[model samples]
Target: MVERRILIIDDEADIREVAQLSLEISNDWEVLTASSGKEGLKMAVAHRPDAILLDVMMPDMDGPTTWENLQQDPTTKDIPVIFLTAKVQAAEQRRYAQLGITAVLTKPFDPLTLADHIVQTLKWV
Candidate 1:
């Protein structure tokens, strides 16, 4: 199996920790984390993880804006991103679908199955 490198950007400490542990243990993924979007942007540029799990709601910079910043940069634009969000309303889903992201994974995700969900969503082998 190709070991995936994943970067998780979430404002919540618990969310970041749980996701890092989940990806690391479940899929043997190399997990890097950042607590905010600004830090996440720097990490994304420097580390260049295979994929980024981005939290949709953050104080300084929200996920869509962060994704846009990622897109504008040549170095990180092509990396696939999955948005982790709690806004599951139809309007929110439609808006996310319009963002051209690979997938939208919900918040309060199952720790055990997160790797599987990501693998399935991204078609990672």
Candidate 2:
């Protein structure tokens, strides 16, 4: 099977690295990471990843803003986005939904289950 591509957008280096490692070790996935929304957008256009895992907050451009920009670009609009954020309030979740996010995964997530969570959320099982 061809490895699925997943783009991770987050300001935290550790989080991005950990997620990349977790998914790579557990499954056949091509992981790409960006440290900022700007970089993420650029990468999204070029790579056309199968899925995007975005952080809610970051310096410069936040996840929502980045998501908006991605959606505006025809090249990446159809790609699914899942918010991997620490902002886990009911209202915050609603806000993510308002942005048309496919799913939201909270911070401090279990590395072992992370890929499964994403698969479940995306209904790829």
Candidate 3:
């Protein structure tokens, strides 16, 4: 079976490291990471990973805005995005849904189950 690639876009180095280690160790996945939206966009355009795990809050461009930009570009629009965030308020989730975001995982997540959550949300076998 071919392994799927995952791009993680987060401003927090610690979170990116933890997620990379956890996902790479737990599944047959190739992980790429970026510390900011700009770098992430570059990597996304260059590599076109199977999926993206984007952080909702960042310095210059937030996840939703980044997602919009990705959608605008034909190269990255088809890639699935799962937002990883600390905010779990009902109103916030509703807003994300309104923005066409269907998958989200709250921060401080269990690294062991994170990959599983993503796969299930994306309906990947």
Candidate 4:
């Protein structure tokens, strides 16, 4: 199977570590992490990863804004993005869905099941 590259953008170090390790081990995928939205944006453009897992809150350029910037960039516009957020309220979910993201994975997620969730959501098998 071809190894998929997943980029994780979050301000939290532990969260990034958990996600990177989980995806790498569970799916044998290449995982890249950025601790800020600005850094993440640069990495996304340079790496052109298969998908991006973005956190909803950050110090600069929150998730929605980051997504908008990504959409505006020709190089990153087509890359799929999945939001990882703690905001799991119904209205919030609806709002996120309206952004046309590939999917949203709530925080406090199971590391063991994260890859599976991504696969099922993205139909990556």
Model 1 C-alpha RMSD vs. true structure (Å) is 0.7
Residue-level lDDT of model 3, residues 10-84, one tens digit each, is 999999999999989989689999999999999999999999999999999999999999989999999999899
Q: Tell me the tens digit of each residue's lDDT in model 4 across 24-58.
A: 99889999999999999999999999999999999
Query: How many residue pairs clash in all the candidates, one count each?
Result: 0, 0, 0, 0
**Candidates ranked by lDDT:** 4, 1, 2, 3
Error of 1 at 57 (Å): 0.7
Greater lDDT among 1 and 3 belongs to: 1
> In model 2, which regions exceed 4 Å deviation?
none
**Stretches of candidate 3 above 4 Å error?**
none
lDDT of 1 at 51: 96
lDDT of 1 by residue, 2-119 (tens): 8989999999999999999998988888999999999999999999999999999999899999999999999999999999999889898888889888888998999999999999
lDDT of 4 at 125: 68
TM-score of each: 0.97, 0.96, 0.96, 0.97
* Candidate 2 per-residue lDDT over residues 3-50, each given as its tens digit: 789999999999999999999999869999999999999999999999
Local lDDT at 90 for model 4: 93
The local distance difference test score of model 1 is 0.93
List residue ranges in candidate 1 displaced over 4 A.
Answer: none
